[model samples]
Target chain A: MPAVIADGLVKSFGDTEALRGVSFEIERASVLCVLGPNGAGKTTAVRILTTLLRPDAGRAVVDGIDVVADPRGARARIGLTGQYAAVDERLTGFENLQLVGRLFHMRTAQARSRARELLERFSLTDAGDRAVKGYSGGMRRRLDIAMSLIADPSVLFLDEPTTGLDPRSRLQMWDVIDGLVADGTTLLLTTQYLDEAERLADDIVVIDNGSVIARGTATQLKSASGGDRVEVTVSDRDDVDRVPVVLAGSLQAGVEPVLDHAARQATLPMSSTDHVVPRVVRSLDEAGIDVVDVVVRRPTLDDVFLQLTGHRAENDTDADDDDSTSAAVPEGAAR
Target chain B: MTATATPTRSGPVPSDRHVVPTGATWLARDTWTEATRHLTATRRNPELLVFATIQPIMFVVLFVYVFGGAIQIPGFASYEQFVVPGIFAQTIVFGSAFTGIGIAEDMSKGFIDRLRSLPMYPSAVLLGRTFSDLLRNIFTFFIMLIVGLFVGFRLEGGLVDAALATLLLLAFAYAFSWIQALIGLSVKSVETANSAGFMWMFPLTFISSAFVDPSTMPGWLQPVAEHNPFTIVTNATRALYNGYDPGMDVVWSLVWAAGITVVFAALSFRKFTSNSK
Candidate 1:
């Protein structure tokens, strides 16, 4: 069985449906990256998987344990690090780990030894005796992750682990995650950073409006949407109106020039390099049209998201908040 | 679904045992840690330590010396004897408000969220807090006991009765801390929990027979004053101090303590779990 399986998951908070029929699977020992904007059912999904919240409908299994029926069993096997660091401010870094160890039923001496080991592993041995309130944000986050691993849970859920960290700190956190993956831990990470997902996830699941809009490897999703995109910038604003006439014959039967007058650029969709760019350049040259620049680029995750959902990933604040809610995309748009 | 897939050795395999630490044990350890930490922090700030210790002492002196002259109890030999135990109960009960205020501070600082995420026993949050407050109450009780002894108050009851009296007072105070825990968990702000906890406590203390004999009160208010939990506890403590057998009131006070602990614990647990959801 897969390490994690969620089927027909539906959740609603009062009048708002946070998740609607969301489903996915994470293979054992693989990193499954859940990507979406804020308010995307990412946090909600994490909460349910962690046994912190119960879904109103649908069933989920973690490590072959039913989440709803055997939540405690599931909880025992899973580790969760929420968006905010949950370390005790009053306890020193060592004490926080010790406390968690004790809670996990380890003997006092065992807990102490484990605490020391973790303190050293997280590079917090020097500050182990100091109160967490004295630690920096990055240090606290590291400690929070250490606390979660005290029990050595099989499944790990990290919700926006690097949301507020600096680039350096973010990279540091990524390295820690990489280390965990190397240890054969099944990780389910929720992130808004496309690069983070592309670099870390073995499989990517894109959720919008509380539903899985797209799911596949990064290359597969991008290629499925369109392999290549050619953008043309006109030399003059007045020349933008002539784009359609200039490239009319070279364009594919279904391909249309998307003119953005304000930006003085026109985008042409193409399946492959082939003769499309050459044909367009020949046609524009024959019309005495001066082209500033023309470039072909592979489809990014953002483009796939925009094409499949009809909304830019970053600018859609609504998708950010209601990440699990299904977006009302325009009909006949890029799937 | 591939049923025969080998159980991979990637991450640590968690146990099937659904073990959760008991509420009492979890709270005892966590609260001790937190209380000691708070005490350490307070110890560093001499001003805070001075104020925390002095405020209860001031209450002891003001109530026994200043108010003793103006009041008289029909059966009691001296007002000092009657007022000292009352003040002890009042001071400890009032101190219980810190449980809620401390929780509020933790909530505001996001410390409560951190605690919630841990696999620790769920009740540990409130239990550790209340237990810590109970320790502080014990210290406050002793300080007042010494002050009471200096002011001509004597424990008529033998060592056992005196010990029982102390235990009863601490139990009641500990129970009251749970009430504060509920408030801390529900209130919007730590300052609000501070004021609101004290506001509610003042009336509970005043309405009881903490200050004077229930017989001395008007006929209309007699029943409430008689049945109030604080009344039973104070009367039991006074009886113990005066060397008189407290009889049924002691048992009733214990019952009240146990009942309140269970009820408030359940309520706080419900509030905590729901908030996380």
Candidate 2:
């Protein structure tokens, strides 16, 4: 059986549908990253799989156990680190870990030993005795993740785990996640960071408007939209328009040309780096038009997100507003 | 199913099985850790500790000494003797508000969501908070008891009766903690929780026979005071302190405590699970 399988999951809060027939599967020992805008049902999906919320329709199984029917069994096998740091501020780091150990029914000595080990592993050993209230944001976040693993769950659900961390801390968290995946742990992570998904996920599922918009590996998704980005800079601004016409099969509508009027230069997109670049160069050479610079680049995850979702990831700040409004307003008022 | 050949350990014995806990045991361990941490937090904040114990003590002193002269009891020899047990019951009942306030703070700080994500039992969060509050209530009860002794109040009942009374008060306090938990979970802010809890508690305390005898109240107010759960607990506690048989009042108080606990626990649990989603 797949380590995690969510089939046509449909959930709604009153009039607003959070998840609309969302479905996916993750192989054991692999990482599956769910990417979406803030209100695109990523967190809702994680909550359902973690047994924190029951779906209005459809089913989810984690480690061969039904999440809804046998939540206790499913819960026993899953570790969850939610969007926010959930560590108790009043407790010391050691106490927090030890508490999770005890909750997992470890013997007093065993719990202490495990707490000591995790504190060391997370590099929180030095600050283990200090209360979490005094810890930095990154330290508390690390402790939160550590506490979740105290039970050694088979499946881990991390919902926007690095939402508010510094660049260094985010990279550190990525390394920790990588180590967990190396140890044959199946992870279902939801994140807004496209680079994070591209780097970490074996499979990527992009959700938009409460539904799955695309699903594949990073390469597959990028290739599905457009092969490669071919940029051409010409010496004359007017000549850039003629290049698209010269390059057959390359649509002028899809070409975004930027003209530098002061230098009389224009740039446009090309189809294939090999065939289109040489053909355009020869065509331009034959026309006595000088080329300033030419380069071909692979499509980034940002490009993939835009191609699949029809909106640039960076420009979609409305997603955050949607989430906050959806969360704050009463369900009845939403109607 | 058929048995399969097992591989032998290559080096040191694998302690993973014993080291890594799972299932119900894990939840039990987590709850204890949370409960102990909560207690330690209360200890470290000496201001909270002092206030929790002092407020009840001051109330006991104020009712017994300052107002004890003005209030008249028909059968009781001294006002302090009649009201001290009542104060014990009243103080702990009022102290129950802290459970809600603490929960509200945890919710606001986003700590409760962290607890929910762990593999611990869902009920553990509520249980841990309530248990910690119970311990604090016990400490507050004892402190008031000592203060009551110094101020001329005595427990005529032997050790067993005193113990039973203390247990009864704690049970009631525990039940009230669940009610507060529900409020904490439902309210929008921690400040609102404090105000709402105090508002509810003030009337509940004043309407009961905490400061004076129920018989001294007007005829219409007498029944309400006589039937109030706090009044029943206070009457039973007073009887226990006077070395008098508590009789049926013990059963009634216990019934109220258990019934309210079950009802409020169910409500709070429902709210907690729904809100977590």
Considering every candidate listed, which one attains the maximal lDDT?
A: 2
TM-score of chain A of 1: 0.78
- Name the runs in model 2 displaced over 4 angstroms: A223-306, A311-335, B1-34, B107-119, B214-223, B244-247, B270-277
List DockQ for all candidates: 0.25, 0.29
Measured on C-alpha atoms, candidate 1 has an lDDT of 0.77
Model 2 chain A: ten consecutive residues of lowest lDDT: A326-335
What CA root-mean-square deviation does each model show from the true structure? Answer: 7.0, 7.3
What are the per-residue Cα lDDT tens digits for candidate 1 across A18-37? 99988999999999999887
Which portions of model 1 show Cα errors greater than 4 Å? A223-305, A311-335, B1-52, B65-79, B101-126, B150-152, B187-192, B212-226, B244-248, B272-277
